[model samples]
Target: MMAAVATAALLSGCSVGVPDPAAPSNPPISSGPGTPTITPGHDAGAVAARDMPFSAGATLAHGVPVGLSEDLAKAPQWKQVVSNAGGASRYQKSDGCQVAAEVRQNQWPLVAADDRASTAALFAYLDPTVLPAYLKPASLRWGGERGKPGPAVDVLVLERAAKPTGQKAGRATVVLARVFGTAGSSVYVSASCPTAAALAAARADIAQWLTVVPPG
Candidate 1:
């Protein structure tokens, strides 16, 4: 169920992931609890600490499980750097299940001066026409199909760090072209729920996920 949502979000648009502009700059968000300091650097201890243990949701159309977690302490040095640099918060189930995950605070610097305006800019920047056949559909519907989404989730883009310079991989680009970690900083938020009311319930967490430190 959750995997479907995540995959669909990806298929519909670029799912958030490690900054990859050349790749699709989109991956799923994590559902956990924690308020920790997030900066951009490396921390091996944090990687090991982030061994998230939780349950797994159904696989998506592409056959991928959703809801994963890891101990931030055990994360690799570079993983920690990207996570904090992106201002992330991992999540997991209290149970012994191993479907852990993390929803890093949003951090894409190249957001347009106006939040709403930036959303469109990102869509255009990651133009599906420019992507390969496989990515076209998702990039075209990056947020959602014709603006319609499943009852549980809403497809919207939010502004984060100020835009950067150059079309360099992680330096800067148009919109979605430069992902948060890789370069231009700005991203879309995919919030999913099982029901309309439940979707509303998830807003608080979604808001938290959007909070990112202003880019310098």
Candidate 2:
């Protein structure tokens, strides 16, 4: 019924669609034939480096959902460059730091299901192996919060990528993404940071900013 999750910015308009997690080019580790009963916690061996916060909030609440609320792009570090309607947007800073939401669906079945497999699928969608060398974490982890999860799935993933062309490529380009679902809606959110400090701050803000509409 519950377990720990192991964990996109999209552009709005200009014909940008919700970046489908299934669209990645690499082959993924299949969820397998049957659902594996994975306890809602992380094993030190399978999940090395369990240093992040345990549970994000007091208890699970449904209905309310999360989104890219902060105008991080408004600040000088990240200036807004593109804006469109229908749940897609992008913002970038001078040093190639940026935040974006590639998918924001108010009601999506994939996320609302909240199955461990679904969560795993979403978390593995970006597959960190393909990230540029020297940018990926020396160690990776996927377990956080040990509890039974609801149909509303909430997943998070941390990764790194090369800065946009012509910017600083070797700098720490951290990518943080969240798959949030509650009540009856779901969203895929992501942000890229130029430094570990920036990613840390951004993760806190994003985790705190999520919302879910409680059912009546």
Candidate 3:
């Protein structure tokens, strides 16, 4: 399970910001698997300023990363914590679950000269040489789904080994989906949970939110 989690972290390196030199230093407290550490002083204003090309208004989906429905937003269990100028948004659930969504101008051209270069970079990151021993038993699957322009989604699941204490093993799952539209617009969403039940609920919420196209 840790192997799958590590692989997903590498694939979804989503943090975007310049560290604030003056910000206080604080260590991250692990809430559970897949929770991101919160940095005290990161300047995300410039990134947020980049047009999201989507609406941040309310939606019907509960605990979604996109425009959260009013009822859910107002509910005691979920809260919106981050809204960056880079068109990135995040929501948190009381149970330590999280949902985040973002739309950015595809920087592939600037990152590399062409698709080949981009693919090379991606392959290098996912090189099998670095995968952990536990990954041998993990399952990975990917497919394309229809969206305004279509998005590619990947699902990974790994069953953990029993503890030395002989307790039952747990499971972890990650779902990474992204869409790249014409004119440089790209939308990406990721949801993860430590258990099958939590992952299922998270995936359902994400699916419902993804259906609402953000206004350009």
Candidate 4:
């Protein structure tokens, strides 16, 4: 029992800001079979400013693609976090990032770019209710930043699992956070089963993904 608990604690990683800054990489292994697969895809199309229907402005992160807004529509499994007040846009991760895309919508603004570190921490520390118990998160990876000064961009991912609890309890959920700077848009994706042999697995992908996106 103690070994299991220790293994879970070691699974979580912390890779914010500095991208893949040689952070902790390896995720805890399950008693089950092999590692999960990640499939990549192109952005769907542009996320029209007018269509936002919620906030006013939306900034693009430094990296990432152009048509991500629309691509999210493709990810049907992604579930938006429910909130009463109208402030930020929201999206959820479905099928993990590889094959699955983001889905859902809301009118919330993205957090500031410099706040990337905080964003990662927030996902890492998400309330158990919002996320599944088995979905253990280790670190947060960059998505994109808005504006020149750098507002919170789109997409932030967590590395490994802390323990096991959510739908993916006993498994790792790569927490993904997406923010729309202008239309107050935001989305969170809990990518599951991150498997890297080294202590730096999460950091490598997190940094690479952040570089792929552009500001909204």
The candidate that wins on TM-score is 2
* Candidate 3 lDDT over residue span 136-204, tens digit each: 211111112223333212212222332333465533444332222212233334444555566666555
Cα lDDT of model 4 by residue, 1-216, tens digit: 222321222233222112222324564668987533221332222332212211312333223222223223233443444322222223334333221223223222224433343333344443322333333323222233422222223344434543534554444434455444332234443333333332134333433333223323
- Quick one: ranking by lDDT, best first? 2, 3, 4, 1
> Runs in model 3 with CA error above 4 Å?
1-76, 108-171, 179-181, 210-215
Clashes of each: 56, 26, 4, 63
Runs in model 2 lying further than 4 Å from the true structure: 1-66, 106-117, 125-155, 161-171, 180-182, 193-216
lDDT of 1 by residue, 126-194 (tens): 443322211211121111122243112112332122123443322110111112222233333343333
Candidate 2 lDDT score relative to the true structure: 0.38
Q: How does residue 169 of candidate 4 score in lDDT?
A: 40
State candidate 2's TM-score: 0.42
> Native-vs-model 1 lDDT?
0.27
Candidates' C-alpha lDDT: 0.27, 0.38, 0.36, 0.33
Kindly indicate the candidate among 1 and 4 with the higher TM-score: 4
Q: What TM-score goes with each of the models? A: 0.28, 0.42, 0.41, 0.31
Those runs of model 4 whose alpha carbons end farther than 4 Å from true positions after fitting are 1-100, 110-159, 162-169, 194-216
Model 2: per-residue lDDT, tens digit, 58-152? Answer: 12234333334334444545565656346555666565555554444433234434432333344444343432232222111222322322222
